[model samples]
Target: MSGFWGVARAIIGREFLRFVHQRERFLAALVRPMVWLVIFAAGFRAALGLSIIPPYQNYITYETYIVPGLCAMVLLFNGMQSSLSLVYDREMGSMRLLLTSSFPRWWLLFCRLLGSTAISILQVYTFLALAALFGIVLPLPGYVAVLPGLFLGGLMLGALGLVLSSFVKQLENFAGVMNFVIFPMFFLSSALYPLWKMAESSPLLRDICAFNPFTHVVELIRFLLYLQINWGALIWVLGSTVVLCTIAVWGYDPARGLMKRKS
Candidate 1:
């Protein structure tokens, strides 16, 4: 048990060190959300007048409504970035060396996921803090309440990234992932516009948003930020995390690691 923790700690420490060295990555993460919150939200505030959503009692600013979604975006992007790093490691043969360790692959991978998630969580809080400064604050308790949702959302998205890493042939392939998976997931969900708004244009699109896993992640964060329980989002996120992790573990199985087969 202690050995597992020891290995986990080492892996997490390495990830942290790597993150710190890449100061630009941290800054970029913060900047993307801030751009959306400060510039984009401000520009859209008048155009995107929100109706009374469940967690909201009355009309709310577009900035306030999109905060959870932007928070989810941070996790989503970081998760994919984690996977991109994994592919890079594999290509450089580092992952091969790491896999040779006595630790189980799933344990090692989970350590990687946890480490990336921790960094992502930090970026999220920083974004939230900056948002508060811009007068886009959630309630005090909401700050505390949002952590669990962020953690779970990060875990699930990280797992998804891991799965993608196993399939992605190389670093160059990552751009396509951002275009296809990340963009589609973000835009199709309740992240930007409410489901009813989508339904107004197209019921099919609204239904698609309802089923999106990212939607549940955003919804979970939204509800928790308001001190409410979104049981459906909770269930969806938990189930999605489990399934994605299982697949990721399978994708990187030493007996059939994609790197080995692809190389």
Candidate 2:
């Protein structure tokens, strides 16, 4: 038990240290969400009207309505960013070192997920603090409640990156993958607007948004921030996490997909 715990700790600790050295990563995480909250929200505030929604007993500004979405955005980007780093680690040979460790490969990867998720959660908190400074604070207790939702969302998204990393062969190809993956995941969901708003434009689009697990993740945070439980969203995020992690483990299996490209 002690040895297993030590292996997990070492893997997680290395990930934390990598983030510490990369100050630029922290800045980029902050910038992406800030652009949405401060710039995009500012422009759209006049165009978007709010009716009373769940968790909001009174009508609130569009800025407040999307705060949770933007908070989720931070996680979305950070999770993917961690994945990007994983790709780099693999190319640079650090991942090879990690994989060859005495611990089971699956356990090591799981530790990596936990570590990246921990950093992502910290980034979410920092973003929230800045949002509060800009006059968009949630209730204090809501902050505490939202942490678990963030963890689950982070794990799901990070696992996605792991799966992608296992399949993608070259470093240069990542830009194309990001374009195909990240933007669609962010825009097609409830991240920027409500489902009703999307329904007005096209029912098909609304349906797609509803099915996307990213939608549930954003909604989960939205409800949690308001001290409400969104059970449906909770289930969707958890289910996706399981699926993605399973695929990742399979892809990274030594006798199979992981070494094929190199061979």
Where in model 2 is the C-alpha error above 4 Å? none
- Candidate 2: residue pairs that collide: none
State in Å the error of residue 225, model 2: 0.8
lDDT of 1 by residue, 1-263 (tens): 99999999999999999999999999999999999988988888888767897999977889999999999999999998888899899889898877888988889999999999999999999999999999987989999999999999999999999999998887887898767999999999998899998999999999999999999999999999999989999999999999999999999886786766767
Q: What lDDT is obtained when candidate 1 is compared to the true structure?
A: 0.92
lDDT of 1 at 108: 92
Model 2, 1-263: lDDT tens digits are: 89989987887898889889999989998887888889999999999887787877987888888888887787777777777888888888888898899889889889999988898899999989999999997889999998889889889888888888888887789879978888999899998889998999999999999999999999999999878989999999999999999999999998887766744
**TM per model?**
0.98, 0.97
Single out the weakest 10-residue window by summed lDDT for candidate 2: 254-263
> Candidate 1's error at 35, in angstroms?
0.6
Each prediction's whole-model lDDT (CA): 0.92, 0.87
